[model samples]
Target: MPQMLLIVEPIGQRAERGRADGEAVYQRMLDFAAELQAEGLLLGVNSLGSAAKRLAKRDGGAQVWDGPFAEAKEMVGGYFLLDTEDEGVAMAWAERCPAAEWATVEIRGVGPCYM
Candidate 1:
């Protein structure tokens, strides 16, 4: 089976609506993931929080930056790893995502890993 990753961007102008609406959208996302799993198309799903830590190499050792990434216009909110036959099927699945209307969903094929 081919594997694909669905990158979900949850931060945007429309996404800042209201607390109740945000919760509703979150529930819908969970429901959609459950439906995908029930159909055996979902391998895994992850919800990413706003907090992030960036690591970098400087002159001597490591440098770190923390985030809610104040300057970013969009941040990845979550992802869905899908197992399917081909890109067409994966694209169809991506199209059915609950937040597709307001958020950005990027579908990318998973390549073989050396490690």
Candidate 2:
């Protein structure tokens, strides 16, 4: 099994940090990723930009919307995919994540949607 660590952050949080602070925080994340890679636990990692698009099909029509969505209080800042079968190990890594200091590290198992 694989687990994903979603870095959920409040909207505008990055802007509040400003460029310098943001860069510093990002460096910390990179260092963390390197540690995971060294441990052979990291499968993939990426930081998400604020810009996003939402698409939906309704009534036989496709609708699309561009964000920053006003209704959303939080956004996914990044993700880390870990190769592991133990949920406990994933949870431990999530706790060690740099984002855990300023954001929510959501741990979710990789599985079929139907499951």
List RMSD in Å for every model shown: 2.7, 0.7
lDDT of 1: 0.77
Each candidate's lDDT (Cα)? 0.77, 0.97
**Per-residue lDDT tens digits of candidate 1, residues 1-115?**
5655555565554346778887887899899889888998888888777678999998889988988677876877778888776888788888898867877778877766652
| Model 2, span 17-110: residue lDDT tens | 9999999999999999999999999999999999999999999999999999999999999999999979999999999999999999999999
- Give residue 15's error in model 1 in angstroms: 7.3
TM-score for each prediction? Answer: 0.81, 0.97
Highest TM-score: give the candidate number. 2
